[model samples]
Target: MAGPKSGAYAIAAVPLLFIGTLLGFVIVGDEDSCVSTVAAGVSVTIDPGSVPQTEIAGYGHEQLVNAAHVIQAGKDEGLTVRDQTIGVMTAMGESSLRNIDYGDWETGGVINPDGSRTTSIGLFQQQDGWGTREERLDPYVTSTKFFQEMIQKVPDRDSLEPTIVAHRTQVNADPYHYERYWAPAVQIVEGLTGAQTGLGGASPAVCGGSLVPGEISAAGWALPNTGPVTSPYGPRIHPIYGTLRFHAGIDLAAGCDAPIWSIQDGVVVGRGFDRGGNGYIKIDHGAGIASRYLHMYDSGMFVNVGDKVTAGQQIGLEGSSGESTGCHLHFEVHINGDTVDPDLFMRQVGVPLG
Candidate 1:
């Protein structure tokens, strides 16, 4: 009987001891253990700081640092995120964010390949006339120079398409070359700053908080049509006219009468027929961002010139009303009156248009 009782008491004491050990560990632990289990059961969230240095995927640390410099330089000059994005996009298109000492006809500050240095160097690959070799190589100076030139040359740069603005400032041979880099540039800026680019509208976290007028929503955007793109936005031979022409917008082949939706919230600015007789509707999405829907059936417009529309709201129906061989929607995105590739513009705003 005594042995049995003693055994039972030991068993009970063992559990108590184990519980005490756990409690002790919880209340007081060595540095390592404490750190490991300090908040094991509690949720912990860390908000990013201003100018957060979060690593951008597929980018080296050096590239990220240089990108940060561009953003900071833009801010220093009181430029908006749009301007900073333009500078970064230009850098990406020119040098992939590297400050090379060589150019088209030169290498390592010396002429190579018999006139290979085209006098373009630095993060922006600025020409020799931009400044001295040293200044061009300096990321800050080059970015500042680029921004100042953009301001001086393109006074309405902020309202213009990023690639167009970059083209005007750089005088590059290809106007749309930098267009493809807009999405990456936006990602880099967001990754570094932990803030939305305000391309479509204010980010959800900062919505309704001192938003700049004409700022696109950072929350998200909508795809006007998910159908296969019949004709992409760019230079191409017109199917109907049989002439080389610039396709200002993308063509989505959604059978006739397919609903065409507004990409973002905005007031309808214009609704009329183009010279080609294609019925169209234009929405001013603020922030100098406007979307146009063309080739709607001549049945009339769903929203009027003064009507305010919301994202995903049906604005019209797709049709081959103007200059069309078949039924489709010709969607155009205009920034400050310059037509940009609708597909690229959609991708930049986080809504990829295929």
Candidate 2:
């Protein structure tokens, strides 16, 4: 088995200068104006409201979340956290967000006379056909060896491209497969914490719900409607702004005044008019996560900021609210202070909205 410490260096070596630089950029304002500071070899400015609202969860979303947990777990096990992105990208390409226990048909490996042992297993899905059963389940053992092979093979570390290239030198699989998923993985990382601490001992955020019993998504665990999702989450034209901005939430497109429900039970966080002149609702699902219901025509809100709600309970009427261009239900799922695509979690429960 590879010494556990070997992998830690791989992950730790890559300084998160990219994230630090990005944050500095976000903090700095235009030089022509005021509110600027020069410090520590860089300039710093602040934009009070530059943080964008985000939503649009999908397979990519889950992969990012899982990757963070995996990274942290690796660190706890005395494994390197650096250069581990290669394994992450590979996992994202192979299984999306799920910690799959089985591999695909083309994903070759182990074999059993009954045709069972060959199944790809666990988060990285090492095949029993290639290794012992114990080895496949131990993420640290599998991931460490994988990284050892990658670093020894690849010469370039300055860019993600060559790093990934080096990692997959033997697969003969498309080198670009892991590269394409990088951006989406980063997006999930940003939305979750605005930082990359990985699982490091940070408890998962507990979101809306009364059960408080089991681990559920920081995003509410239920859908706002049993009705099919009318529009998928992603890039869409702002009906009012007319500028292209990301659609942070999925639109249910339910009939106006129809009963709308909460995904996971939580407390009413806010209910009132948004700057756009449409009535809106915000629910605090706990653990710094919240849900929003927008475009209600009526002034009466079903819950208050502190009022607890049950999952799937009627929370409001679906109507155009807050600068809305039409009479459609606007919904949002937020983690910490950032919005993530609700569709990602929606798909987990097999909700058929879209």
Candidate 3:
């Protein structure tokens, strides 16, 4: 938990019978932001004066309050923290988290081919087709409308990257338009909720409710990334080399920049480019056991050689930097400095990967 949020707002355990005074220590995460459930048809009213932080993610009180409203709408819709983060990310990309009455047309943008200006407004800058002007201007209503549309447009949202899902929902010109705002939106949502929400994408190997996606297993080891195994360890045809080569590691379908965690507490023994300039990091975890992550770009590397890292700590972002065709995580488990089947070893350690 974030521990005793003493900045501006006070969070309470309003959902339970007995409310605790301790801050940031709760079962359902930050209660100050979630007022009531949407199934109850209770309107989430955001009073800008009550917003605690003067700024978060470079946004002032007004913008942050609008974010809270967006989050509140997500909550009302029974969405997860990941979904909430995406909602906020989309809003930030569209309007800088501000509920502006003006839209692209007013600013000489998004001109229609028919010589007419498209009308978009509100925090999401949604077109007039979304709702009436007054409804579009209302943060909660606009956000809810956005969420409803997203649910219909992207039914497989959980399996996709946040920006891709947002793009599909918004139908914006560029798919990666909202990419830069994703990290900031994740920071804002996690800061407000005290919950670990951003897992890069909703990878399937969720062990349990108690464990975050990557931070599973009790034996000082966790899954590096929850993405499913796209390629298994064995002799296989190399995609780039176009020759049958002994595939050394398992490839996960993690997309670009997905946070990859360390599977066990260890010291970084080596980190560099392979013969093909594929970025890799090898960690020695003692007992002749080691692990390595490959294909991360130089910028994606978050640790240096000789640095001690703990299990579940993020080591790098997923990338396709070498002789690879696409973005993926090449993970290898080692025994006595020799490569082993990561899927088998991970399963033996309580965290299984496909």
lDDT of the candidates, in the order given: 0.64, 0.49, 0.69
User: Of the candidates numbered 1 and 2, which has the greater TM-score value?
Assistant: 1
lDDT tens digits by residue: candidate 2, 225-249: 5445766568988777889888888
Best by TM-score: 3
Give the TM-scores of the predictions, in the order they appear: 0.46, 0.36, 0.53
RMSD after CA superposition, every candidate: 22.7, 19.3, 11.6
Model 1 spans > 4 angstroms off:
1-54, 107-117, 200-206, 209-354
Best by lDDT: 3
Candidate 2 lDDT for residue 198: 24
Worst 10 residues of 1 by lDDT: 1-10
lDDT of 1 by residue, 1-354 (tens): 000000000011112122322222221122221111111111111121233444575667778777877876776676766677788888888888887876644443434234443567788877767899989888888888888888888874532456777877887767767877877887777566544333321111111121112223466477786578888878999898899998989989868766677899899888655545577888999989999998764332455667777887666666666577877888999999989988887887788776
Per-residue lDDT of candidate 3, residues 1-354 (tens digit) = 000000001122234332222222223332433321121111222334456866777888788888888988886886666677789999998899888888777775565545567777888888767889999899999999989988888875644556677877887777767778887886676555444332322121111212223574667678898788999998999998889999889999767878788898899887655555577888999999999998876535656777787888777778886677888999999899788898988888888885
How many backbone clashes does every candidate have? Answer: 13, 25, 0
